[model samples]
Target: MTSARPLPQYLVSRFHGWKATTYAESSAWYRRLVDEGQRPRAMVISCCDSRVHVSSLFGADSGEFFIHRNIANLVPPHAPDGLQHGTSAAIEFAVTALKVAHLVVMGHTSCGGVAGCHAMCSGHAPQMEEQTSYVGRWMDILRPGYDRVKDLPEDQQIAALEQQAVIVSLENLMSFPFVAEAVERGTLALHGLVQDIANGSLLQLEPSGRFVEI
Candidate 1:
């Protein structure tokens, strides 16, 4: 058997406050969205980090973005084997059904998921290598990124690999046939972003193979 519980009181209170203020003030917009449908222009794939507020970071309004969050903000290579794939499913729908114009894979510094992948690959965390480790299995998608940065000095290794996380996801996202077609037709654009969690600085990767502060 499993257990379920109500939301915490503090969060509930905050929700009520938001409903009374923001929701009430934008009731018409909310009703319009309900009557029509969400036609988000962009799809943001971000990490499950509690500190990364996708909407807040972009100052986005409701229904503006179709967002998906996963560990390390990873996108595994496309595999149409009739298996369950939550992230890939979201990407498929965004590219095919919703026809989003942009797909952004956002990574962040000090990410626990990225750090765990680094540790597991470096043989620093044996428990993560166990067969029962779901996180480890999921993070295997990032092993190539770790391999790319493994030779760097220890002080610069994790941060370098963090950027590689974004690179890997960007590469994987393009592996989906539909996504690739959309980009080829100029209907969709791909983006990679990395944030400095400690300083709130943002960097965006350019097509020219550089990451510049934005």
Candidate 2:
């Protein structure tokens, strides 16, 4: 069997620093969390971009949010084929088991995944069209989103597609029975947001299907 390598020195050092400072200051709070278990009120679906810090963005402490990160912050339509579906599994747990009050799909500007989807759909990224490309297949979920913004000027497409990622995920999330039932029962609410990385500004999707800066 292949053995895992030792942890990176930089990460190890950071862990030690956190333990001595942040963890030490909050040790009792941490213990209470471990004993009580997490009961976060919101489930956040966010991009896997390194710059998109979900906790920092929301001023969330540990155990404050149930977060799920993906390449494009996507939630595919419900498929009960018994295959592995990590995002769906997380959603199911958050909605059913955790009973989170809110589910938020947050996308961001300059998302590589959205950019790739635009490129692939625009016929500029032939490699992403190959069947064997996992990223290509995953980004296919955003093809419908691409079609929505394809006619816009080239400079505006990527930004619009980024917001569409959040919209698409929110739409797909409703395809899950548990999520839909919760929403119908008034036990769950869904929100969609897009963040601008450069200025740390947020845009929220309103009931009218338009994004307004907040």
Candidate 3:
């Protein structure tokens, strides 16, 4: 059996501070969000990295965006195998139920998940190849991205791989029939982006298959 623990004091204090300040100031907005429903205009798929704050980056209010985070910000190819797929489920809900107009895949520089994938694929992390390593299994989704960047110079591979992560997710997003239909009907559009964490710069994937500063 698992044991439950009390909330950490730091987190508790932070929550109280927010309740007294931010939440108190926006009580009506909070109540409205509950009374009505969350109608986020976009769904952003980003990395689970703590530094990648999606809301702050876009200056989004509480209910403005539906964000999903996972290792490497990956979106696996659509699989209807009756499995518990958290990322896919979030994508389905965002696209089908919430009817989000935009789907954005945001990758970031210096991502540990992407680094692990590179290490694993390079045979430097043997333990990650084990069947019991959940992270390793999840990162297998980015193998194709790794392949695309493996030939680059060592110094350039990680950055290239990071962008490829965004590209791979954008490709995978289309594999979902609903997403494909939504794009085809001009109801939803897909975007790919890479954030330079050190400098707070953003690179957007353009139609010409290039990542350009935005």
Candidate 4:
């Protein structure tokens, strides 16, 4: 791990036709999901990393989570002013149109994305001004979450911060008019969780540091 090396970028490039091949592989099951109108019960907000995959982690196939991912698993407040927001669009579809019974913002341990947010808050990360990368903008949504938990010890910092970010993201979700209406009408349930990837532990917060295992 001393010398960092990029992943085999072409490994995925070799699978360009895998999407089409998948349809042919499970044509019947996919058609069943599509024809069922994709009324998924839960929507998962997860990281964009191929390894930290939501589908494999949740044991779900296609159409399980009306999924959204970014540098980190962040849910920006549905604030769109001449900006194309993919996360907001996914939330709109899942909460309103799909009527997903639950919206879960799942954060995990040792995430590079969450680590980036932590670094930014600690002044270890470079300034984001004039940055053209999409990640910088996405990380902005998580800055407050970092501030919210920056006082904790390093061992507990990321888990605490990421867990709190899940809560913040859930709150941000409600900022969307559709999400607010849905939650107020009791059409959607908002949940937040931090995944302990090391031990497969799923800990939930109780408005305080008290973590009750679920």
- The regions of model 1 sitting more than 4 angstroms off are none
Clashing pairs in 3: none
**Superposed Cα deviation of residue 51, candidate 3 (Å):** 0.8
| Between candidates 3 and 4, the TM-score winner | 3
lDDT of 3 by residue, 83-108 (tens): 99999999999999999999999999
lDDT of 4 by residue, 1-214 (tens): 4898756868666565666687679889888986777878899888776667778777887877788887678888867797888888888888778889998888777788777778776887676522784566678888888887878888788877777677778779879998888889997888777777888887776666565778
Error of 2 at 112 (Å): 0.3
In model 4, residue pairs whose N, Cα or C atoms come closer than 3 Å (at least 3 residues apart or on different chains), thus clashing, are none
Query: What lDDT does candidate 1 reach at residue 86?
Result: 99
Model 4 score (lDDT): 0.78
- Please report, as a residue range, the 10-residue window in candidate 2 with the lowest summed lDDT: 1-10
Q: List clash counts for every candidate, in order.
A: 0, 0, 0, 0
lDDT per residue as tens, model 2, 116-206? 9999999999999999999999999999999999999989999999999999998999999999999999999999999999998999999
Identify the runs in model 3 with alpha carbons over 4 angstroms from their true place.
none
Whole-model alpha-carbon lDDT for candidate 1: 0.95
Q: For model 1, what is the error of residue 92's alpha carbon versus the real structure, in angstroms, after optimal superposition?
A: 0.4
